[model samples]
Target: MKNIKIVSLTACLAWMLSLMLFSSCSNDDANAENSGGGPVIESVMPSGYNVDGSMKPLTPVTLVDPKNYYVIHGKGLLTTQKVYFNDFDTYFRPTFVTDTDIIILVDENTPFADASNQLKVVTANGTAIFDLTVAPPVPTFSGFNLINAVEGDEVTIKGKYFLDPVVTLAKTATEPEVPITIVSSSLEQIVVKIPANANHRNLAVTNISGTAVSKEAIGTALYDDKLYGMQWGGPWSGKGVNFDFDGDSYQGEKSWQWVFGGWDGGNWGFDVDMTPYKAMRIAVKGTKNGQVNFSVNGGSNYVIPVTTTWVYIEIPLSALGNPASVTMLTFQESNNDGGNTVLFDDIGFVLK
Candidate 1:
């Protein structure tokens, strides 16, 4: 009986000692897991952060061994974290990559709390924290087209990243695109004034940071000058008044012309010749009774009445017997009784 009691007491003491040792080891392991030096940050959120770039905060911060650890914050143990640049206020989900790297994407439009341009990193354990400098996104431009034009007319230009962009004309040695004052800016479109006398060719968009030129494109071009034909001397000059003949006032005395086969003073009823250039534009101003006939082939047969004042008449080269060799245009009239005087101006020919 005495032996049994001593053996039982000894067994009980051994069991208590083993339990104490196991408990100490377990505590040490737990402390090791929660050490101040948390998991290493492999990489940061947003590969390349730019000044105009955005961010999203409080997102998941993945860990290399995420299954083995948890994240912490003011509230409690968290599975993810939100981090961003100092001046950026965007939100991001921090994802753990490896012992040395993590991935994150900041919410757009959020200014970082700091301008130092630092990328923040939080460990999965929530105790380890660090920062890595991030770079802002580079500005770029694409697609440029000319607007509202024919050859020789000025037009506006359309494209991307036009706000505060360095505008320049491509392939042109002299003509360059000036800077466009952007009233608004976006990711897809930009409106601006291009150089005058622009031609279809390549164009360039640039900034202090970089330059972006377009693939060869066609643009509106400008034209040269226009040409006009010369004026010819005729009875119905293209003007409102004619000075080839003297005055013919029925009550007033005739100056230096004859009237109706009767000598008054001087040359009165006269005819002039026109060159062969297809057609003649005739302008005449005269009294209602001042009748005149257009004769072709040098003969007096068919006559047309001239009654309208300051009226424009077009006589075709074909009417005169299709005179392939027309030379002179004669006007004949017999004023038995006249009412008022007549006038003419600006008789000329235009090239077809």
Candidate 2:
């Protein structure tokens, strides 16, 4: 009798537990099916660790960051079929969904410009909309310069993610950022009026995500309109290369335009110490995509592939045999794609 009673008790406990689980699932399913009312979003909260690693409580944000997860707090979300950030169709997992909350990751490809600026949720019963802004990733501050720039000359900044950008120039490291006038802006380029106060300081571009600072500053170019401390180099006007006399430029009036034949090349002469610099930088584009062998002091060639669009690249000095002095800055056509014209500007070096 004792053994029989024990078995009965065990069975009874198992039945109770199963009944409770069924009831819980049933309640959730019922809530999800009760779609007579539409979904609503009360607030959106960021997920995960903070940048500072502080224990400060997380708060709701009006901005949705790309590549980050966020929680949607509201009712009627258990049966949510879709969520859109900035009208972008974002993917979410159903197992993570619930009636009052949803954990979803914002896709990195979500549009940050020219969008509805909305966070929408569609459920079985209805849909809900929340006002939210999608922020672009941190801006990339490749380089900026103005050829023969005076106090009010237009300076062109090159990089990525210039959406709703704010441009500032700091005369020194300790000084506050001074706002500059913007002439025009695109996703990867910006033209701003150079302030008189600009000096050997830093330039920064800020967007919703964060700021990107320049690796160098104004009045620091190796070749801006003219070379600084440059001895002599290049096609030398009818010798091997020429300027864009027609006025197509990467920044200012014109850039170095080279139309090469097969195996054509040119060299720039410089008698200056390069120990203070970290890399060789330039903004270049080609009429036809091709490659060139760039060398310093006739070191091992650093092959640079050029595209049709203007692109700024910084090649570390170490890549070119780490020459301590600038003797020969050479460019030789190696594309073998017949020959093509390439435009160059913002020729310079970056500080260590």
Candidate 3:
């Protein structure tokens, strides 16, 4: 009899448990019917939405119908939400859904959320609302030309749309890659130093945003050998020779002063103030025997060199080594009897 009682009690308990589960499931079905089965998307959060992810000052979003959107606080129906892009988590992978998308509306410090057509929607039904994209502005370079230049000469570069602060010069067939010194800059102009090995080089502007490259151009030239020339003097006229007549030889029976001052100085001379690379060259002809004399400090005396015929004289002020200012050059009669004539011509300077 006790076994029968135990079995009957166990059966009663199972019957009661089944009744409770069935009642719970019936209640859930009745609630679903009352609420219309799912959250109704009566309105969208952002109305007339258009924004660029790459643009500064990211755009804001709004609700098409604030009352119907079911906003939690100030945000829209899907308000107080999180966005993920490109991955499963919202950490560092933030992506935009098109150039103008909802991702742009997120705060800067918020973690980037993984995004997908399947990952979008209200987090209830997996549905994609917007596409993600990025639009970076294309950079351009202008104002480029090949200037007459030497290998190590310094030069200035001018251009437009150099948005980046730093400038890059790519290596050429004749020169190595180099970066120019950024002295000053503007929207349309940038001033930088030409590197020592810069030649036939390609230029570019760089920053975090993008780079702008200019066509290759030659470096700039500073010094040339054409800085000096020659001229012919009198016997032709009363006026002195202007270093314009290019003659292989010149002859005269009269003494002519090869005035090296003024423009003829080639901007060179001896100086108490130590300067650099100053030189003068005057190829003179004594057609016959003559004495070449030089003086400094106003001709109190003369240092003479007796020459036999035409010869080249290179009077590098550097060789003179800190001589007095206002020096003089004169060719006189070899016998010192006076009236002996000598010719002077072919005046030039070496600039290197």
Top candidate on TM-score is: 2
Model 1 lDDT per residue over 83-181, tens place = 444545434333222222333334334332234544444435563343433322233443333322234333334443343455555535555554434
Arrange candidates by lDDT, descending. Answer: 2, 1, 3
TM-score for candidate 3: 0.26
| Alpha-carbon runs more than 4 Å astray in model 1 | 1-118, 124-164, 171-184, 207-210, 215-352
What does each candidate score in C-alpha RMSD? 29.0, 10.9, 28.5
Error of 2 at 94 (Å): 1.5
Stretches of candidate 2 off by over 4 Å are 1-36, 49-58, 145-148, 170-174, 224-238, 245-345
Off by over 4 Å in 3: 1-136, 149-158, 172-176, 220-352
Better of 2 and 3 by TM-score: 2
Model 3 per-residue lDDT tens digits across residues 1-352: 0001112334334433543353355444543453322222221122111233221221222211111111111112122134432323332112221111222222222222222322223323223333332111334564332233444444445554344457768654655557777767765666666666555456777643357765324431111111111132122123333333333332111223332221121122222221322443444554345454543333433333434455646566555443434333322333444423344443323222
Q: lDDT score of model 3?
A: 0.35
Better of 2 and 3 by lDDT: 2
lDDT of 2 by residue, 196-298 (tens): 8675556889987888888766755766554566577665233547654445666555678788877788888887578667888888888888888888887
The TM-score ranking, best first, is 2, 1, 3
Which 10-residue window in model 3 sums to the lowest lDDT?
66-75
